[model samples]
Target: MVHENKHVKNARYVRTVESMFACPVCRASMKVVHYQSLICSNHHTFDFAKRGYINFMNQPVNTKYSKGLFEARRKLMTEEAFFEPLSHAIASAIHAHVAKPKKTSSILDMGCGEGTLLSTICNKVSSRGIRDVIGAGSDISKAGIAMASKNYSDKVWTVADIANPPFKESQFDVILSILSPSNYAECNRLLRTGGIVVKVVPRSGYLKEIREVLFHKATKKYSNEATLERFSKHFQVAEHFRLCYTTRLNPASMKWLVQMTPLTWSLTEEKEMSLAEEISNQITVDLDVMIGISPK
Candidate 1:
């Protein structure tokens, strides 16, 4: 593997981060220190891991994003090849919205699971001669953020709450939220006046094979209407499209999918075992990519 000076590299990350965050407790400026935490003048401190990510959330957390869930997500994502098309869609959308003659720009991937999508976008942008773009991703799960930081040390990865991003206001050019929750007011607070928010949600028939095994009856809940309602409240549409792809999942990956995805959480032990037995090979994969622009 590769190892470099975290402190020196972190200085670059801190420079950009200070531009996207405010003190959640006091709304003052926060600074990045070698301790890997964001500290305010009032002495409210957050901890950063050896992997080079800091958790800016103030209080305790009680979400389903435990270490096990993050671990399962990593294993499945790495093995199942779920990110290729999604990354392409993200890169295409970013290219459409980004302007030229820019120095170092920033993109924050909120609820970035394992940093795959952001890393892919950065590499693609760099290939197109935009060497100064940065891909920063943050998640509530420490393990998730830790894995991302360790693997993609070249980028800025943090364990920050999007509700209160640990960076300055009006600093990011693009904010991405894929298969995660969003707070549009917070997103607007982070973006520049003309910045963009690229969000990805599941379409009507996303992950049907997994859903079939996990639930006896499945209903379409994550529709474009629900997301558009939220986005309309804060953002205007610059461009929008749907990305659809079909792929097959292996056995181990299929099992990991069952555990990692929220769809199977309600399944009983007996039902889960039966579902596992019923699966042989290949599960369907589908998702949508939505791109929106902040009102200038």
Candidate 2:
């Protein structure tokens, strides 16, 4: 058998994702105009890269997250089993909320840092019984999308912003925003009727150990009450699933965790350097998963 080049495999994947995408400029339906490019009626086009992802950004984004951080987070997320529980929770939520009419479901993860959560959740859901689950992830960070596409080649990955998603109307069965910001208006616009929006927010105790080590008084106490209140305004809150647990962190994992998060960025170099040794302890994973829907 002749082995297909990486670019050829990626070009084929482009066909699978065409229906979900629209021309970011004209909002027209996109087609696989070429093996390596997607084009819309208005002639707007985006090219698929050799590594199996597409860059659909209209403008450059300057974010606090860097490639190094995303790489580290991906390592902990997949190899070290950091967020397996949350992945299962997300999979279960999708299974329960997805419309019963269709056997196949399409899911999109907004602000998907390196696509770890989406990949893990979709894989789990499919493994259990739902073999027709299709998952895609998008983020403003090109570096993050690059890593995601390289590692999780099966899922469609793109570089796009949440405020203006590059997907068509009624394209997705579920939209996931895990530990990331949400644009409810855009999410509602992209979902099918009775489609689901799964938003994961951090609870008060999330990463409390790291917080305690970094700042005691000046740091704002964690809160999601305001966020939930905001979500309720845009979506009908169907369910609020909470996942709170503790996981032991070794020095290596702790180092990556600290480096991955932006919380330590504000600290002085001396404080950050001095605090590294104290992170080898149990850390809390407190999160509230909100399942919501737009007004029908």
Per residue, candidate 2 scores C-alpha lDDT tens digits across 183-260 of 888999988889889999888778878888777543366667888899999888989878999998777787778878
Clash pairs, model 1 backbone: 19-168, 20-167, 20-168, 21-167, 21-168
Off by over 4 Å in 1: 1-20, 34-37, 217-222, 267-274
The parts of candidate 2 lying over 4 Å away from their true place are 1-3, 217-222, 267-273
lDDT of 1 by residue, 154-230 (tens): 77777778777776678788999988999888888888867889888888777776666545566455668867777
Model 2's lDDT to the true fold?
0.82
TM-score of each: 0.85, 0.93
- Kindly provide the TM-score of model 2 when superposed on the true structure, using C-alpha atoms: 0.93
Which ten residues in a row are the worst by lDDT in model 2? 214-223
Whole-model lDDT for model 1 versus the true structure? 0.73
* Model 2 steric clash pairs: none
Q: Among these predicted structures, which one has the highest lDDT?
A: 2
Worst 10 residues of 1 by lDDT: 212-221
RMSD (Cα, Å) of model 2: 2.0
